[model samples]
Target: MTVEDPLFATPSSEDIERTMDILGENGVSLVHLQFSDIAGGGRTVSIPTALLPRVFRRGFRFDGSAMSGGMRQVEVDLFLMPDPSTLVVLPPLPDRPRRAFIYCWVTRRGGQPFAGDPRTILQKQLNRASAIGLDYRVGIELEFYLYKGESLATASFESPHVSPSYFSDSDVGTALVRDHIVAWTHELGLGVHGAHHETGPGQQEIDLRHLGGIRIADQLNSTRQLIRVIAEQHNMKVTFMAKPFDDAPGSGMHLFQRLLKLDDGTDLLRGEDGADISAIAGHMIAGQIRHASAMSAILNTTVNSYKRLADGHRAPAWATWARVSESSLLRVPSTPEGTLTDIELRSPDPMANPYLAIAVALGAAVDGIEQKLDPPGAFDENLVHYNEEEFARFGVEQLPQTLGEAITNLTHDDTMREILGHFIVDQLLTVKRAEWDAYRRHVSPWEHIQYGEL
Candidate 1:
């Protein structure tokens, strides 16, 4: 299909006009066209609200070579055409002009969608699912740490107790941050379910209601931005790093997903009995399990992400599925009588580009359905405590231990390679491999303390 086909269609003129009118009514003076780079970093360029109409017509151009992930110096020119459907007014900040934000799709000079663009990569996969009359719905639980300053040395709070202070109501600092985040996210139209203190000191979590794939991705990006902005207003810094401290609990972007019938919105994953999973759910879980190892490279994009996947940290270290165990790579959360059911992927972190992460995941699920793949039987018991012999008997496999190993797995996994496409994969590997190499060559305090005198 063409780039402007139903899958990635540009917003209609009427839709753009309506959005412009809404922005005008909201007192928005600047319009920010936002996009995500390959490393999940947010990028933006702002224009006066009056210029948005011209942007919609001609598309904004930039030098992609300046960015980290997608383009090289030789082919530097890239265009960002804002998707007007994503337009939303930013929450007002004191002493700042009211602004609006719209996500953009990366295209070439001639307006063809850039294959290496993370959003386009996701849209392509969404189109694949749409072609089959299915819709992918996703909910994300984002975990992050709030600190007094940008570095650990300047951290404001430190707990002396060995036990975690999960859900504690006493930390007024963190509570205020959470309150602002919830308020701002709601103002931005993200359906905020709840926010609370996590296991680690100064750590927090926010859960957003499930929505369609693209919408959820957009909201996720917006959520991160708002969280950072709100925290800065309070003179605190927030980090979504998978593991910022070696001894503390790591952050994760736990993704809950399900499929629905396009025509009637019937949940395809629901079985006859509420307690049991349907056949389609099984196949999708099987697909996720089959590709879990390779998927880790993208889901856990940073080197520190591997540190969170250890045995006792609640992060899954094995490629296993279970109905209720949080220790498994995939878990089926218990649903109330009338609530929606979905699968939770525990491997992802906030460092991942949400667009690419969800795209590959849905692609795998669709492949599983198409192939009628059967996932391994559920391992209800905690696999972390299982001996190697028991794990072997159950055919459970370990996830890659390091970023290098994960990249190696990604290189060999044909299914994942096909889903993300060779171009995106090549670009990702090039960027990530360089990061791995730099990390390998760096000298750390631990290394110096261990070897300097010895």
Candidate 2:
């Protein structure tokens, strides 16, 4: 029993109609429409080419039972309204079928956005920025590890240098795989600034160029999917879990952001008066710092993620900012005169739902701008090596040490509940709390080893 609202007009009618002509001419018979579940997991629905016009003009409906993650008390029909702009001629892959697919906006039967939808949630926050004549362009640096073949988190190796700038003869096979991946990335119109080996064994970093609005989040999802397909083709496996191996450096998804004038495309952070630091930029930083801990539950998103956020892991261990410190939660890497964007948020791991992550961040930033919040004095040094005593002396606060802690922080932040709907927030609490409870109940090998001696 589902119905489309009369006002729920299909998006970009002309563009989709035109694209379908090309798709039909190219002999494309199937399309996979993709959307994110509440946790940012990618889900898809395959539609025949014949249904393209109807699906685009109306929407695709599916049972909510499978993908809802228990958010709904009863199974209901959910609609996916495809984003025509994301229609891509997906090149054939060995494992996947030859088809074109588009990302989508999740909606309810009445044509209203589903409250738990990540993309819709993000769009709401961005709309807040848009209302004020502001916009954000985001650049993503995602790190993941390549394992030998079908490996588990327990696997470990002797390691490479704790450096990202070096690549050796040992990187040949991985490099070739990455080369093919990068080529396909370009083919799909997801351009990359760089792809290279990172500090840990078989770790790699791929930097996606800055994109505006929901497009970057959509592309981030596509890129992660692409990485897996490419890895499987080469008989290698990849892990985006923040810390898979205890001994190795944790992987992170560093976000670089800039505020822009929506109409004129001016870099507002540079300021009208051309001050060294704009009030907007300071407030943005202050806003992000204010919300960092609560946002961690969404950005980090896993029990293993906290391990990556630990000290000495080249990840942000504390809620701190610096002009250029790599180890702080927020780092402004450049200035108004510099060639690069100034603000980089370093705490998010690859496990996060990019949509929710960016939404909370942007929401917090918008709050900062609205409140005219002032940032604290900067903590200029690399705090990765700093102990708690040193942190107190410098007045920096540590991020949550565990998933449980992160959940607690999230509960206290009404801003997160307000920004991300209560439906999503409550769903996360239900799921993550269960996970933490299960972890607490389970017995590990360490317990056996220690208690056996006792």
Best by lDDT: 1
Question: Would you estimate the TM-scores of all the predictions?
Answer: 0.95, 0.92
lDDT of 2 at 239: 88
lDDT of candidate 2 over 42-117, digit per residue (tens): 8989988888778776788887754555645543777888878887777765555568878988778756778878
After TM-score superposition, the amount by which residue 405's alpha carbon in candidate 2 deviates from its true location, in angstroms, is 0.9
Estimate every model's Cα lDDT from 0 to 1. Answer: 0.86, 0.81
lDDT of 1 at 408: 92
Candidate 1 residue-wise lDDT, 1-454, digit = tens: 1136444676678977998889989999999999988778889999999988888877888988645654666558888888887887887778999998999988877678776788888888888998898889999999999888659766766343433378887777778889988987887788888999998888999998998888899999998988988888888898888988877888899999978888888888888864388899999999888888899999999999998886368898988888878889999888877787889999999899999899889988998998989989898987767987888888888888899999999999998888888877888899889999999999999999999998
Question: Considering every candidate listed, which one attains the maximal TM-score?
Answer: 1
TM-score of 1: 0.95
State the weakest 10-residue window (summed lDDT) of model 1.
155-164
Q: Report the lDDT of model 1 for residue 183.
A: 84
Name the regions of candidate 1 deviating beyond 4 angstroms: 1-5, 67-70, 158-164, 273-275
Displacement of residue 247 (Cα, Å) in model 2 is 1.4
Off by over 4 Å in 2: 1-9, 94-96, 153-169, 271-276, 335-340
